[model samples]
Target chain A: MTSGTTISGRPGISAEEFGYLAGGPGRAAEVAVVRLLEGGLLRISREGVVSAVASGAAGAGTPLEAYALGAARTGRMLGDLVKSTATSEAASALRQHLVDRGLVVSDARRKTWSTVRVLCFVAFFAAIALTIVFRVHFGVAIGVAVVALLLRWFAGRMRRPVRRAGRREVGRVKVAAGDRVGMVAQMGLLGRVGQFPRMYYVWEMLGIVPSAGATLRRRKPVRNSGDTGTMYGSSCNSCSSCSSGCGADNSGCGSGSSCGSSGDSGSSCSSGSSCGSSCGGGGGD
Target chain B: MGVLDKLGVGIGWRPEIDLTVERLPGVDFVEVVAENLHVEHLPESILLLRERGVPVLPHAVSLSLGSADPVEPDRVEHLGAVAEALGAPLVSDHVCFVRAGGLDSGHLMPVPRTRDALDVLVANVKTAQANLPVPLALENIAALLEWPDGELTEGQFLAELVERTDCHLLIDVANLHANALNLGTDPNRFLDEIPLERLAYVHVAGGVEHNGVYHDTHAHAVRPEVLELLGELRSRVDPPGVLLERDDNYPSDTELAGELAAIRGVLARHA
Candidate 1:
């Protein structure tokens, strides 16, 4: 009574029938029966009556006979194909293998590796975002993560890893605002030239530090850290709102690349990397 | 030790618990749902227990902090106000996303593990934290499906948020078990992997069976598997005090007593 369970009378009631009963809408008693059959707790005879199925036995009939008798359909099949010895945990893993291949539906049961992997990913990214917020270098953050993951992966191979799948996603960035950078200068003769307003029409700029419509003084640029007073922040990459989301006023500064000084490819830069994709992700810390 | 106060081991607040109200075992703490606070919810048909010494915790649902756009800042602000009024140590909300960019998933949809998403959670957490006096502790939700782009586990992601933001962890033991059951992972390993230092609270709730799937529907009594895992957590991780959650089927006080007794039994083994 390995993977296929056979029922005597109802010759075609596969464990799939038990799968439906175990999963489908049914009375508590009926569900219990389905569970018993599915769990290999019972076998059915030709009369359609149920009987206990021994847990320690090998296949007692044809695969279809095993199916009809309500044997463990998943167990023998996996045992034969993969390896001789398989624990319930291992069996569950094989079950997941089928689901992954789309042979079986996966919405019902949880898997340890998938759960652990997903949760670990969720926690890792969360930590990374926090690290980014603390201004930790992306390299260092990923480095630390790699070391930890390697340790865990190696450790799991040595010991039985508690496997589980968790589906949750969070990404964010925290950029320091409220800082000012460039100074304004009209394109006229040095120091305003004692002229009235509108004397210097060529005064285009970036980051008006002193006041409104001010021109920025050109300065040398460095990578990553703030050079021009604008602090960079990063979080869950998918932030929905920005202090000044895409709008008409974006023509000057906020539009980043579309302003034409930078390429549109480089336009959507935010707290961290170049932006331009849909920036809606986190709750915005 | 006893220095760690008990979390919400509230009256079962369900009829199943009611069955054994008179013979129910005693619990150390209790929590009343926000919906059941007023007479309109509890009604005169049910009498509130008179226990001044017992701690009462209030949990809220449907606060969509993960919504992309601002829906009602007032709603969030109001919930903060209530948690404050009640002197709750930590206000809890689900990590599931309810709406995005003004469109409703109509379910508690989870986001993918991208940097952009982390940013959103941090922003939302910050907003909620600023409004409330108490730190916000988010609970892990059970998801029937997953986003394709995820690169991390829910535990790792939650732990990271706690480590970075100083946010408290509300470890839901039942959710853990349900995840273990639904996702086919080793419960023992998951409990061990989570960063336990940030645990501020914990949850245990019963689940439902649908189409051979065990769902964290909060309908049944706290499953024994959940209790066993809680005990394991106590031994391995020194988790926060436990809370027994009975969301559906109003149970009698005595029935809740039994659930509490079961918890205490698990606790005694851990102790």
Candidate 2:
């Protein structure tokens, strides 16, 4: 709870805590599901329907995991599973604990701060309007507005749930997690899908198609904070258009080494070429 | 000592099954497609493998050494950067062309097996080798058609290329099987001619036959004939490394592990 408090003496932070610190309740739920899947307690079909493979909460390592496993019994979709789990009693309890530790802002406190901040803005604007209508001395209006502005700033600061200590904890956990799948799980769909593209079934089940163009445009070189090496740049301008031509610059030809061709060994055999037979029609060796 | 270091059985490191690759036991090394990766922003799984002291080889698909055009400098630089980043002992690409005359074929296309093509390939290989921080290993590809007027056999061409460039070889037995089935290129002839001492590793993958054409679809299970061919190669030389390539339609981790085990089995029996 405190800045100096240690979650454990172990190297990496727990996936649940890391998820909550990094992304909140929904992410924590997702991490739990990932854990269940990794532990072989749950199964997700290619269509994205998640089902509990194990009966009861026998193999679950945490309360959240047990809750997730129980919720998955009826075979909910991935999105639904995360949504329901986030609102579950277990997730609520976890959130309350974090709030008590001052790592997160309670919903009630956040709402109160938001209302006060809005009132401050309204009061400040009203004071200026009154001054303009009465043609009174502007100094009084300016002073009133300044006080309102100060109050608004304080409320805004209070509205943010994650405290400084929480941020520090998140960073520590991330560094310790390193390149492990635990880190990937903490990142939710983006990290899981990006690192494991073969899991496209997750997207298919979610009833959403990821835009290739958007994905390519948003892609930036991932650099660790400690890394000081130069990051290489990609010339792929458009994901859709570049498939056939982007990397095909004079720098090198973009051949499909996996595309079923004998060209890699200095032999002539192209499934895409005009010749369809075993030996291309041209000349004999 | 072997021509290359002892690299136990391995599998292709793909984005889809990254975690599976990490958990799968007995994986001595993993090969990554160079073009699919950005040297600056590598996937964490690859970095993890490197951190674990696992050999990560960058296999490029776009070097197009067999093309009539000059080797791409940017591509070579990228491959070199990847090798340096992973601290790999060597890297690999195919012996085919992907583009010609400013047009991209998008698939690996065979090069003419004449002296002229070999000269061009050798020059490109040397250029790539000079730029790369590690030794260059070239893999033979699976093809459906053979170009006319070829002057050399596949093994002779690869042997001459290695002799001239002092490069290494990544012989793909699955490709040899595909060629044998479709193009009538003898796998034994290929194994007999190439300098096995220069072999850095071997690639094994599964494929299917449709209408009598054996497609080197890395998606399928490794065919028995391919494993037999691997055994035949094992009979000739002790390859330092052997990797299973599964690019698409990935099976369960159990199936992949079984394939790797099958590869190990062949190596053990032949040994």
Candidate 3:
């Protein structure tokens, strides 16, 4: 649920600003903001900050729903100081999770266009496959492959050419394709950085016991209740190091997680561990 | 010789403890988490297992065979690659789903012990078997929750699965103990329900006490209750080997050696 705010000319608004926008603080505004944020019905940004690229409930049925869910989880983590991943890192984690799940999130306004692009990609692949099945002549097979690759390239290019529309859904906030793609890409990268955090979740899910390194020792219990009251607490405060050591924004406690730091910062994979490597960088394992 | 042929014990593979496993004398065979597989970067210990003639069988988590959705062919294909690499005698997965169409419960969820699930599981097992290099075995996981529409008892569910798929069993005695303690089901009756002849091995692990309920934590050495059940199974099933699973507070080789002494004492006295 999201809080609602009525802008003189806008449609969807964030819960954070809904209380201020509706001229008074109330439950409806808080709800409107949360629902809008959860459903990604808003696009947020400041004068110099990158736009808050959330969309409205209109994109619920599209692939962007995955992105929205990630955003919501990130937002909740943001609200809860759930150690590891800065708000931005969390946003990226949410984005990459959606991508790994095969959901390609884009601006809601460009939904129909992406749908067409996917269809063109499919049609191109189908042609190539069919040519192989039909035992097309060598010359013809090469032609089909070329045509299919070209069509795929064309579809990818079209993914970038969406006209910039100034229509603001979340109060005067206008969203665009570039912002959308950039957000999706940023999330993808962040998702990789979120590996340790997610690895935590996966082991928890599989009932696999975790590796308790010297770092995890002496963890104080921070329940979901620890949303505020302290700008920082626990391991982060005791050591001013970001708890995440991955990424953290200045606004949150320092647990080492900065939205911008990367886990693959200096480490490089060995040649055998490459894409064709056994760890299944290609998932063959 | 294989782990079964040697100390006749089943050991958990901790990539970190590979060298210790080789240098130490008592470990039988290691039940490698298919995740144990860093195919390209085989832990120096796995190579040692090979050098020392230790068998390392794989236990997988993501078969997702019992899902309502169609099984992904690539999953089995990848599993086959692991199976092919290890040449494990039996590849096992939890009796649960990893994902559904639009959701992931993120736990080893239990399936209803119904005819429908039986058919689904068998089909999934057959599919995995067709692609895998060895026979596929199914393990009985410690289920914390039950299906509202379950059609069979946990033992009956397992017996039928073994019958249908011809899959061997890696019955976790600790799991059965937890099931008994958690569900308040009698362990003797549960034991009588399944055919013990299909059991190739057994798993014993430690559990935690939460709200007066026992949960499989695998943190400590095998608890006393599970050891008791293992004693019972030793009398009845005469399973091949007993594996010790300690995932959390992995003691040093010396610490584990002490635990192994306790296990070998039981296995030997019974023999």
Candidate 4:
């Protein structure tokens, strides 16, 4: 998912250098380049400007070549201009390949880790309870609590970085071409601001996407999805915004509907409703 | 009256409407999803509420106290940790089972009203209470369907459970309305049957009617009938506080304020 030149099989200038011609990493721009390379449909000049090969597979005047040539001329990286944007597909493909070759661990390991973590917690608490029952002394209780807390804290610290590393395996490059160019250009103008753009993905994961007020507004579509009547999508999204409302990233969605169904409080106790411990913030009605 | 008596109108501190909630002109306290909050990294909004001295109740949804299986000690420990971290005086969860036989229903499924279910719920509640750092109040859930083997009325079941466990009640008037509307039961009769003194706080929420069945979805606006039910409950027993719960389709700040105002108005008239 890096915006760099890691298209392992491709020859000639790396994707980053080709991106330099269009200004930066993008979906449509990457698709055009890959198509050109695959079908030998375009000739990339020594100067990095891309031009249609007269006997190209897509021919000179075709929409694909025209778009590629246009991107080359204007230094624009088209991302998501057409339905065939390959960024997501490429990321998934690469991820699967890595998993297949054992370069990356399979998702089943993550599940095992999670289950083990929960069991660790259960064992830790059970020990604490046993200590309290057996010792029945204030000093013993304090010592046990302090030691347990420290152990839990250390365990959490150790797990977080590794979990984050595992997560990066699936983190796709979602940056658009224009934004990428703007990011590069603005890096100098905004000293530490350069680090800020890279943090966008992380911040978005945290649901605190800075300057995404409009993006939040566009999320109205979520409210209208099939789960709208049940308030599943919006509630879960809101719950996730509540600092990882449920346990896993998407677990909130499943429990969001569950929280609202006849079983829990149906809607009230689900992520946002104030029904129970997982009540998103709203009282369970 | 308990410490909750001094507290007044408040709303659930939903992250989606955190800004709207934070800006409320007057609020006694706010409740947060216990599972959503991490003890070490609490939401900034929740921290601000604590800084402002607004009580934050950690409401849990997955405890599944009535499940046949023993409650997870880890889950109870997590709840205890959250309560301690937030300095909450009390915490709350539902009286229904969320998972059974190792399969999570993903919803609060109803426990049978039989004596066997009652014994299981009482034992689970006692275990949860022992693990919790503060008092645990359990709320009754709104069920779309009832178990066939029910041997007691909902009120009688709650009354007996509370009597046995010495637990408090987080009564949801909206749930009462839903049950009354869908189950053909009298909400007033329900109010009369429950122990009024056990009321910790009252919960009011909104739901929709679909195909003649009232669904307590908490996604829609709080219907007037729910407010009326709250009024009726207040008349019978002035609960320590009333919290307005709005889960989704969150309206503008003005509308939320209006809902809070309406709740306050109801409390005022009853008072």
Candidate 5:
């Protein structure tokens, strides 16, 4: 049978029960599941498998119910399903329903703190205005502002993610130190002079350690034949470790040396179009 | 083709920094990220670069050419189509696997430097090469970690791959530096073994170090040492071209132009 088709006594579960199983079993999911189970739309199997009660002939259920049923029939584990986006949505909606109904306990301390925070911010602004206009003590104003910020920070410490409702917050993937540094560098924060100097030096400036910091200078201008210098040179000759044929013998195909810088006339190999014919259409390895 | 004749200096073309790219003076060519471009609707800035006769190389990042699984037909086809669409001189991808066993690692994974892995890479590269509209240049990638029992060095593996498959090498100097620092491989030894004649071009990008590991980040300023490495490679053989890659935290036009100028200055020094 299709997962949607209800058999007799298949444990009366609703969208809520399915959601609870699919979603995480935190207080939000738990409270929501209980409220919906009480509403008579949900049923629980003896095996604890949750499904929706047969509403009519075909046993059609809500999208959330069908999703949960399909997941269960496929033998999906609760641990796996909890991470799915569909489960998270169902759980969030159910949690919101419970919150609206006053079924779950709300945090009184958080609510009171939030109210106090708003008053504190208003007073803080007023203090700044007084300092600016009436020549109030600047240090006292600064102290008050610092104390207000600290109070808010402490209040924020008592907050719990599950206690809040609305948009579902998926946890961030832990970033590696290298990736984090790279990201900061990419954001132009590291590039700005004197910002994050230690980070900039350790990460961005670490490259200087290898090169021995030899300053580069422009070479003497040669005739524009594209023959800037001999392809093979004595540059590698100075190294005593140069064993793998790096010195004097690595001259490339000497075709491009005769070409002038003014045009592509003396060049032996055509750049893009020539390769298109060779590489495009067909070729064998 | 003589890569040096037309190429004086080039910058990697990213959509976010198109304005700065367009303003670069004496830019001989630009490397486009192949996966980002659709054959049907390529970005206008890239088209404009083509119109200006700046050679655009299709640098593919997702080919996973080192995977044990057969290279996907669609991916190869897409790259072929992009090469054709851009009229590219050559196409390039890393000689690293980004996925294995039907799961994507999301970043380039170092291939085990064993004969078996080499054989897999050879077959895959050959398959990809046959389908590509231009010659394929496989780049050496930066490995965050390496196999404990790797049978060959990075240079040996790449040289063998090039010898076996007749593909070109998109030698990323920064990657070589990163590998040398992080994995304890010899960079000069790497340069020594590789066939410099088959250089499709060169890639120079910015990177950083975190903790004790050096990262090829491509988001920061090019280090002087990287330029020194480029110069060292030049001392070995004259490359036809070199392209600068900057993937994020794009600097202002003035800063980018200055960096390009710095690259030009280095190339001139080596030339």
Candidate 6:
């Protein structure tokens, strides 16, 4: 679902390009990893370890994919995989390409903008000091301070790595990405860790916390026997109590017996009960 | 058996795999958990499926149809509203109680197979059916333990319920597999005794064996035995629809497709 041109007739951005524009090299690397995982070229374990099952496959078309495949050959943890891939020569080249297309600010330009903003802050304080010491008109000093503050704000905006065009391009990419792989790429470009419900485990494996105050709420992972966390207002201790074999001794009730209890007490078990698995012994609706 | 329109093959739709469900090839229908959706604001993914003419069935979990208490009107209302919103042909819930004595169990507890328990369940089902806009189908759940003083088997209990309430049945073979392994319930006997003509659909899911017990986890891959059970059911009747459910620990799309393919393969072989 890649598009070559935006609606405005400008060159559109690829998912990786959008990732770089939105969050930089690391984000682009994450998109590549997701692509490989979706393509079945790589495998991620429940523990978040990534291994390349077919590293020599012809699907490693992009440079980042090639780098990610190489990194996963030895079964690397997801966090380390992203880091190693992000710092690789391929990532550096991707950053350079985005800069060349004017979608992102150059490193030198961003550094200069940051320095100018600091100088503006210094000028603001200096003007206020001079006004108080030399008994100059308060209006003149206030004007100087206001101008310095405005300049500092402008410099801060200039220092942002992603330019206006780049943001627009990323937005376009998001609209065009309608399928599963594209949606995963959109999550990467938007810095939405754990936003993609199916891929949250991947982010958790990457050891990246969902960004603070993310718009989309982070959903609790699905409860399984493997997850001992609390769910549905109940805490599970172990898989033993939740198993179907918990009450094997009490299978049948006599016809005239008083065992016709309205509620099945064995259905839901507490943390202390022998059937303490809060997930209900793995039998879910 | 021809009462239900042919739904072919489908999968359970979850918020986690919205896009995957939307793009999965040959998806004839999808079942959404009724308790998880809001009628006023359905998910875009669901709306898209509806626009594409996919049958979106609402499967409720908290209905507590087998509870000793009367069926809750609010829960029934919500299920009805979801069905109406999705234009669903029918809706389904479990023949088990999730809450009783004002305490929520959070799991589908099997109803005791006693005449007294059956009387209460019949009354609740009729109440739910009267309030529901569309037809309601009840599914059999896998139980870790059965209540004592049982006067009937699982099949006889369901057959009487259908006779009393005229509700449909959603047979889950995986749950049958779990029961066959854990509680020694005879799947063949259940199939033989139940009224197959009243079956609206079939449910197939995956599970794992742990400590000599087969757990109906729905997180793992579908075992060979569960598929064999599906084959057995297919041998008895051509089910209107067979849906594959994967609730947690979702596999890759390729793996999920393969599972669906395996289910279709079993049906095809039996056919």
After superposition, the stretches of candidate 3 with alpha carbons farther than 4 Å from their true spots are A1-285, B1-7
Name the DockQ score for candidate 5: 0.01
Q: Model 1 Cα displacement at A32 (Å)? A: 34
- Docking tier of model 5: it is incorrect
State each model's TM-score restricted to chain B: 0.82, 0.98, 0.92, 0.98, 0.97, 0.99
Candidate 6 chain A: 10-residue stretch with minimal lDDT: A248-257
lDDT of 1 by residue, A113-212 (tens): 3345445556567668868689888778887677656654433222111011100100111111310000110011001212366433111222111211
User: Alpha carbon lDDT of residue A78, candidate 4?
Assistant: 19
Q: Estimate, for each residue in A1-285, the C-alpha lDDT of model 2 and write its tens digit.
A: 211112333343466665565545555666677667765676554335566653334777777777888887766666677657766778767766776777766667756876887799898998899898987679988988999988986775555445556555655653233323244323334332223355532222232223311111111221221111000101111112112211111111123222123122222211111001111100000
- Ranked by TM-score from best down, the candidates are 6, 2, 4, 5, 3, 1
Q: What share of the true interface contacts does each candidate keep?
A: 0.00, 0.00, 0.00, 0.00, 0.00, 0.00
Instruction: List runs of model 5 lying over 4 Å from the truth.
Output: A1-285, B2-6
As a TM-score, model 3 comes out at 0.48
Q: Tell me the tens digit of each residue's lDDT in model 1 across B74-187.
A: 656656665554555666676767876667677666656555676677677777777776667777776676667776667667766666667777778887776776776566
The residue-by-residue lDDT of candidate 6 on B1-271, one tens digit each, is 3326688899999765665677778898999999999998898789889999999999999999889999999999999999999998899999999999999998899999999999999999999999998999999999999999999999999999999999999999999999999899999999999999888999999999999998999988999999999999999999999999988666667788888899899999999
DockQ of candidate 1 (2 decimals) = 0.01
Best by lDDT: 6
| DockQ versus reference, model 3 | 0.01
Tens digits of per-residue lDDT for model 5, B1-271: 5433456578998765564577678888998988888999887678878999888888888889889999998999999899899888788999999988889999998999999999999999999988887888889888889987888888899999999999988899999888888988888999999998888888999988899888888878888888899989988988878889998655555667777888778878877
**Native A-B contact fraction in model 1:** 0.00
CA-based DockQ, model 6 = 0.02
Interface RMSD to the true structure, each candidate: 17.1, 8.3, 21.8, 23.0, 25.6, 8.8
Assign candidate 6 its CAPRI class. incorrect
Better of 2 and 6 by lDDT: 6
Clashing pairs in 5: A12-A42, A12-A43, A12-A44, A13-A42, A13-A43, A13-A51, A14-A42, A203-B209, B3-B240, B4-B240
DockQ score for candidate 4: 0.01
Provide the RMSD of all predictions against the true structure, rounded to 1 decimal.
Answer: 32.3, 20.8, 22.6, 26.3, 32.1, 20.8
| Best of the two (2, 4) by TM-score | 2
Residue A65's C-alpha lDDT in candidate 6? Answer: 84
